[model samples]
Target chain A: MDFLTVIQLLDSTVRLATPLLLACLAGLFSERAGIFDIGLEGKMLAAAFFSAAVAALTGSVWIGLLAGIGASVALSLLHGLASITFRGNQLISGVAINFLAAGLTVLIAQDWFSQGGRTPSLMGGARFEPITLPFADALADVPVVGPVYAELISGHSVLVYLAFLTVPVTWWVLFRTRFGLRLRAVGENPAAVDTAGVSVIGLRYAAVVICGVLCGIAGAYLSTALQAGFVKDMSAGRGFIALAALIFAKWRPWHALYATLLFGLFGALETRQDVITAVIGIKVQGQVLGALPYVMTVIILAGFVGKAIPPRAGGEPYVKER
Target chain B: MDVVPKWAEVILVPLISLMLAAILSALVILAIGEDPVAAVNLMITGALGSTYGWGYTLYYATNFLFTGLAVSVAFHAGLFNIGGEGQAMLGGLGVALACLLVPWPHWTIALLAATVAAGLFGAAWAAIPAFLQARRGSHIVITTIMFNFIAAAVLNYVLVNLMRPAGSMDPATARFPEAVHLPTLHDILGVVGIEFSKSAPANVTFLIAILACVLVWLLLWRTWLGYEIRSYGKSESAAKYAGISPFAITMIAMLISGGLAGMMAINNVMGEAERLVLNAVEGAGFIGIAVALMGRNHPFGVFLAAILFGFLYQGGAELALWTSIPRELIVVIQALIILFTGALDNMVRMPLERLFLMIRRGNA
Candidate 1:
């Protein structure tokens, strides 16, 4: 492809990667504090449904985004309560939340909207709009660099930028902030953190809540930014993909961005396999090519990966001996 | 014995959760301007009344039993295996291929080969996670969940590309030749002139599932291997001290569990549909977790829990026909059941047994 085309792909690649990156970071924060947080998918699904519904109803994308976040966080908190406080099975609880969200969303969508999923299409104001900064517009007139600035870096939803920005912010909070240290300490060794005069329960709860908030933004971005509105199972295993990104990134915030972007690249490749096949002159069913990302991901995770050490008591419930 | 009421702990939480979920579901219906009472009542009448619905529900319950057994076995070993879906898919593929492609002189032999193939594939799929967990200390939960997605995606790819038959939105294989479909009990129902009006899929698979349940119970309670598994599950460190290899036992337990799931696929494919099909067993494998949990990891309990889910599966949709709501509400209820069963551990049988023993001794 020409420079302009390559630049275009680069910009779109980042935009596509943002949702997965946001989600992976969301998972990273919670899991780093030693919670499995399996409900990320459910949270996303819930947010997607709510955001779509509210966006279409009130005709305000911003309000819809807030509503979506609220819905996801509520479900996330429900999962947190069951998994963290009740010390329930993290995997099962997460799966349950997902199931509930899936069923409830569909049921409600059908009830109110009367569509077999595929929420009513959004209008101009009800949808998240891409913004090209004034500088981006000016830079678009330059030669090769113009195409790069115009196509790749500009005219994307604002969330895309915010998602990238969160990486540095996350690193700061997780490594430098006291709350981050306490959260990390709880995951590594609740006993020591407890002895250090921090209430491990309180710290972990805060961490989980933070996870819910990030998951909310990720979900809102999914419905409003990534796609126009929610469709049934629109999350389409992205939550699990984000989990994969978490492991791939080793739960580091900055690394998560790269890991998620890599997955997104694979995703883009899979989607653009038609273009790939045209260029290469190969023949294969589109579905097989599409399945490549998941297959390759599993292979990478299962085979070459060295080891993933979960937080010392990540899935265990803390029962104070005293 | 301590004065704690027997069966209270074993039963209360699940019962409460079931009632609460049902009530909440009813409220949802009410909010949606639907009559919950009439809808549920129609579902009950339809499921239990006609022979066909009864048969379909029983067939589904059998699926639940196998999947639930698979999950429960791992749970008893202190392993949470979310790979039942993948394992079951592999098992379904195995049975379908065996029944559809294998050349067998006799139908009975063909069925046997298909069932074995299904069981073997299921075991193999499960063995991947088991082996990883045993050898590398990998987290089975995440690995299994990840594989579940891969399995579905791969299965879809294979079915649509390689195995799809002509003129079908459903990516299913050629129907298994007549030799494979299990004989329905409706034949007997007719012989006695006690017509099972509307015919059901009541066949020998139910008997096989029960037999498997009995065998699982025997193995769990009466065998040295079972003892080792239980001990290992209760405390891996202690199990190691007692000379059992956690890796070996875990692999064996998970394989067996997965094999049982495979057996469920046999009933679903060879015994019923008689073809390798996409969505053949549906999400029964995943639903099995709820079944196994509700049964509190007991053979008999699983049987009943499977029936409950079976009823929901049949009724959840049937109610939809009579109401505007889709039958998938059953899945919602199923999700609620799984959530409650997982969160409240005391409903499980073994712990209840221990609590009972403690209570009895304290009273004495």
Candidate 2:
């Protein structure tokens, strides 16, 4: 492929991968802290709808973003209440949250907007506008680096940069920070953390909340930036795909970025099937191409690619006495 | 002697949880500026009052019965097989193929052949995940979920490329021959001199679903294979000690689950739609998870749960048709029921256990 074509593919990969990256990071934090969250999809859906609804109403993307985060966090707290407080099955709680979000978003949206279960199309300040970096225009004429700098790196919604930046920040938090240490320890052995004078429930709840925040950003980015507004089931299977990506990355932040990017590339190819068909000179079914990420995930999980061992204490709700 | 009665454990807990969910759902309806009482009345009338409503409810319930049984069987083997959606999709393909490839003389012959094909197809889809989980140490939930999506893509490809009728704009297979079209409830009931809704989609597959439930009950409780599966589920190490292989149990359980899930296609593809259409599985596969949970992984419980969900679906459709309540609200209600009955069980159980303890202490 030519340089510009490659850059364009990379650009599309970035756009598609942003949501998966954010959700993957969200799952990373939650799962690394020993919580198995299958509800990332549901949380994102809730955030997307709330964000879009608020953005349409107030015509301010910021307020909508906040509302989205708040809505997602509320669901996270609900998960915490059931899984942590009530000692319920984490997976079941996650499934319930997903179902709740899926249904509630459309129900409330239709009740409020009456636009057939969708919010009004967002525009102007209500939607996220791409930011061009300072050197983007000036560097546009430069041969090899210009388009890569201007087209691939500079022009993206602000949330895209934030998502990419979160990988490093997550790495720092997970390794360098005391809270991260405690979080990891709690996941590996809650009893050790408890004996060392840290609260297991508190740390887990914190992890889940952080997860909710990241998922919120991802969801808001979808409705406000990726698309003009929220539609029912707009998150599609992205949350589940993010979960697959998380497993593919073996629940690490950096690996999550690569996995999501690879998956996003698959998705990008799916959207641009005609271009790919012309380039490859073959008949390629879009559905089969779309199925690549999921198929790859299965192959990876089956230990063909590499072993994926979850956190030692993941999925089990911690009991204080036990 | 156990403090908790078997009957109470089976029935009481779910009843209380369902009641709590209903109350909460009513509050949500009230919040939406609608009359919760009227909504409840409408739901009952719409789902149960008329033969027409009953027909749709039973039809939906038939689909749930298959998928719910699928989930329950896997659960009994300590596996969370979430790929029922995908399995059912493949089963639809099997049904389509069976009806299309051979010119059966009658619907009975077609149903028989289609059942085997659908079961084999669903089992084949699930077998991959089961194999991964059993031999390769993969998580069944994740693999099965991914398979669901893959199943959709495969079904789409087949429908578009292979099954679509010539010159047709729709991405669906040509309708099955008239001889292969299964008898609807109206046709069967009328033969027995009982009037039924002519347009209702409930058909002979509903009987098959009930029979499957009965067979599942016997298999789980009476058969040696079922015993082995349950023992393995209870403790893998213990089962190993008892000479039960985890691999065998997992495969058997998932195959049965997938087969049950696949059988749902007989109702949808052959009975209702009469064609293999894209996304015909819809969210029935996911709903199976909720049904399994609500049913407590019991065959009888699954039957009741399926009917309840079928009611919600048919009733919800009526609500959307007649009132301002959106169709998605039904999903919210279903989710709430799952939340309360499945996730928040301990919320109710802990308090109930304590109360029971207090009563027993007083008696002592």
Candidate 3:
């Protein structure tokens, strides 16, 4: 492949990876604190709908972001109420949340827009405009490094840069903070954290809320930046893919970035069927490429490729001894 | 002794949960600027008002009966088999191959052969995940979910590249032979001097679903294997100490689950469509989850819950046809039912338990 084609593919990879990375980090926070959240896809879908709807209505992307976060956090609190407070099954709660979001988004969209369950195509300030980095234009005429910098990294929406930056921020907060230590401890062994005089429920809820916020941003990025508006089931199976990426990363933040980017590359390659056919000397089915991430995750999960051990307390509700 | 009475546990809990779901669904209708009462009225009349309506409702119920039982069987062994969608899809492929490859002399014989093919395909699809969970300690929930996507891809490839008829624009199999066409409800009822909707898709597969429900009840409550499965679900350590093999129970439970899910294709594919088509399962597999949850994973309860969902589905279609209400409202209701009955059961159960205790104290 030509250098420009490679650079273009990488650009799309960055764009596609942003949502998966954000959702992976979201799942990271919840799962790290001992709460398993399969509702990440649902939360992202809800956020995508509300963000697009609000942006189309009020013509303000900031307000739309807030609405998106509010919707996701509301669902997260519901998860907390069911799984944590009521001591219900976490996986069942996550399943319910996903169905709730999937149905509600289309229902509300249909009610409001009457255009077959989709928001209108966003315009002007309602959408996230791509931001060209400083010196991108000036360095365009330079050799290989210039195109790599300008074409591949320079022009992406503000959310893409923020998503990448959050990786380092997450690593710092997780490894370098007292709250992080307690959160990780709670996930591994809540009884120890409880013995240390920290409230396990409070820490877990905090983690869930943080998860909601990141997922909300991921949804917003999909609707406002990556695409022009909301579409039915727009989050698709990205949430599950994010979960797979989290497992592939072994629940670490840095590994999450690389894992999501690799999944994202698979997604990018899916769009360029000609490139794949040329390299392999045979036409590959698009569905095979589409199913790659899920198949890989299943392989990893079976421990054929690598073992992915979740947190010890993950998916279990905590109960204090009387 | 149980804290609550059996009658209340079976009847009152689901009743109260359904009411809560209905109230929330009503509010959602109000938010959409539609009349909740009117919508409910329309649903009732549309789904139950005529023979035609009952035909569609029963047809949908047949699909749910198979899938709901699929979920319930796995639930008994503490396994959540969410791969029903994938299993059902593969089952359609099985049905197609069975009907297309052979020229049967009779419909009954073709039905028997298709059922075996569909069940085998579904059980084979589920076995890998069950094996992983049983031997490798993989989470069945995640593995099954992954299998759903893979199954969808497999179906797409088979239909497009392998199964599609020559020169056909659609990614669907050619029509099945006349001998393989299962008798619909209209024909069956006609033999009994009863009139039914001629165009409706309700068929002999519905009877098969009812029979399967009975068989499942017999398997779960009457058999020693059922006892072992239930014991394993209640407590793995206790069951292990009691000499029940966890691996055997898990595999058996998932195989039954996958087989039942696959049988749904006999209704939608063989009885109704009479040919294999892409996206035939739609979201019925997920709807099965809601039905099983509402049914309390009991065969009888699954029967009742499946009918209720069938009513909602047919009625929702009517609403979409006549009114501005979207067909997806049924999905919204289904989600609420899952939320209230499965995830948030304690929200109603705790208060009911308190009430029951108060009544007992008064009696004392």
Candidate 4:
């Protein structure tokens, strides 16, 4: 209700939306290349664990980011091997990867840390410190613009900025680049791309790898930047929520930013149930707010509000004609 | 005309996949600095060495049987119902309502009513997704996943606000009436002078689960609708050309799947806990996917896979209680099995097919 409260909510919204935006963009890349990845959650969880674990061990967040990306890329390659090379069911492969990540992360975490499937809480340089933007302190006294610039926009971890920045980069790469054209062609009609002398498998694999990198950054952001350390099931369905956001955005990059931000707002509202109850003049359950994103996704998917059509060749393995 | 023998297709492939999964699980155990042999020994003895363990195993297997059959029925119709967890949770709500609202004079009647209520609730929960998939071209997988979360939220609301007994802090329904308690395996076996574990939760629902398996086999293989479902699954365009209705098959298959998944609540909620609680289904709905995958979507295969998982579950619990191996090892194994058998089928099948062709050529 108050301006400060609204700013604070928006700040948390930006923080929460970072992972979703990253993962949504990740899904956009993979799905646009004809590979449906439901395992985004699993990949994020694995990256979250490894990033935190390595960060705790080596005390370097940069090295941890690399490890996180490496973990995600490894899983992505496995998915590629199953869905692309072997021509297996993409959804089943995604499901397997998800289960594998879910189990292995906790299993290994318990084995190493013995903290009941949690890594040691990160501190100092091992975590991503908040970077206050230039003039944030100086402009604090100015009215609406100053508070918005200083309190809401500034003081987020570096990943938050990167996540937002990647949106434009993704839009440029997807719409303007030759590789992007070929990737889109592969997802829409792999045969046309193949006939044009591009290797469908290679292009798709590239897209999948890119997806892995983005998802890895998202996971590292969760454990290292957002929270202090990895917790069991810490991704906590964020992957699926990201998938929903991807659908809600209709697999577009810029739209993904808005979709993720909206979902993030729902998350912020869930955390601020008291504020919601005050505004509504009646008790509103956090569970209802928590379920809002998923419900909205289903409505979008069912084409109630608008159609969210996926790539034409999405979830289908490409087999070259002899 | 098949390259591989029927026996090999049905038995050998899964056997080899199971072996691969076992080897990978063994390596995982070794990586954890634990002896795989001792762990296996402990699992075997803990799960099958005594009636107490068997009770727990059978109880778990019963839950899997319903959920696994749920997945299998949908798999036959080419519709994946991954919302089994949500459906089962709603099913628990159904069972709770049926048991709590009516003062049933007998457990038999209560069981019948609860089964119907559970199935209806599960089917109702699944209906929206099924409708969207059938009519609107929405992906069933995504829609079903969304439904699972919604179902969880709905169940949470119901338990916390509506069902929770006054003054009780826990978000769970009040206990069902004593008269509605189903007979446990101990009580049933005791009548025949056979010893069984009294503390174990395995109950008459196990028999019901067995019966459901038989009924599902009959429905899929012996009925006209099953033929239509299989045909539709094999080739939708061909089925349509042959006059089979795609919408009808999808709707029917999903309803059956959701109903079967919902029936799992009878075993867990009514027979075991006798109270509806948050996360009552736990992860059994997801486990159903693994079971159905390993079982190759066959009723008989589902029965065996359910028992195997049941063993793993009970054994894992014992392992967690006895050692540092943590219970999540079973989940890893389950993942490996799904990977090998479902996703990476060609990884095994291609080599096996080549070997079979070579053997046949040599024989010629």
Instruction: Please state how well chain A of candidate 2 matches the true chain A, as a TM-score.
Output: 0.98
Residues B1-364, candidate 2, lDDT per residue (tens digit)? 7666677778888999989988988888888899988988898999999999999999999999999999999989888888999999999999999999999999898999999999999999999999999999898888998999899989888888988999998999988899998899999999999999999999999999999999999999999999998989889999999999899999999999999999999999899999889979888988998899899999999999999999999999999999999888878878888899888989988877887889989999
Note the residue pairs that clash in candidate 3: none
Query: lDDT tens string, model 4, A1-322?
Result: 8898999999999999999999999999999999999999999999999999999999999899999999999999999999999999899889899999999999999999999999999999899999999999999989999999998999999999999999999999999999999999999999999999999999999999999999999999999999999999999999999999999999999899999999999999988988888788898888898899999999999899989999999999988975
Q: Name the runs in model 1 displaced over 4 angstroms.
A: A278-303, B1-6, B165-170, B191-193, B197-202, B344-364
In the range A3-99, model 2's lDDT, one tens digit per residue, is 7878999999999999999999999999999989999999999999999999999999999999999999999999989988898888888888998
lDDT (tens digit, per residue) of candidate 3 on B51-105:
8999999999999999999999999999998889999998999999999999999
The TM-score values for the models, in the order shown, are 0.93, 0.98, 0.99, 0.99
Writing each residue's lDDT as its tens digit, candidate 1 over A1-322 gives 4565556556667876887888888888888787887788888888888988899999998899889889877877777777777777777888888888888888888888988856898878888899987688788889877877777877888888889999999999999998888888888888898788889778777777777778778888888877888788888778888887787776788878887887776666665665566667986565554455555555555656655566777877777785
- Give all candidates' CA lDDT scores: 0.80, 0.92, 0.93, 0.95
Summarize candidate 3's per-residue lDDT along A1-322 as a digit string, tens digits: 7778889889889999999999999999999999999999999999999999999999998888889989999999999999888888888889899999998999999999999999999998899999999999999989998998898989999889999999999998888999999999999999999999999999999999999999999999999999999999999899999998998888999999999999998899889888877777899888998899889888888898878999999998999995
| Pick by DockQ: 2 or 3, better one | 2
Model 4, range B29-68, lDDT digits (tens) per residue? 9999999999999999999999999999999999999999
Off by over 4 Å in 2: none
Flag regions of model 4 displaced more than 4 Å.
none
TM-scores of chain B alone in all candidate structures, in the order given: 0.89, 0.98, 0.99, 0.99
Q: Please report the candidate that would top DockQ against the real structure.
A: 4
lDDT of 3 at A81: 94
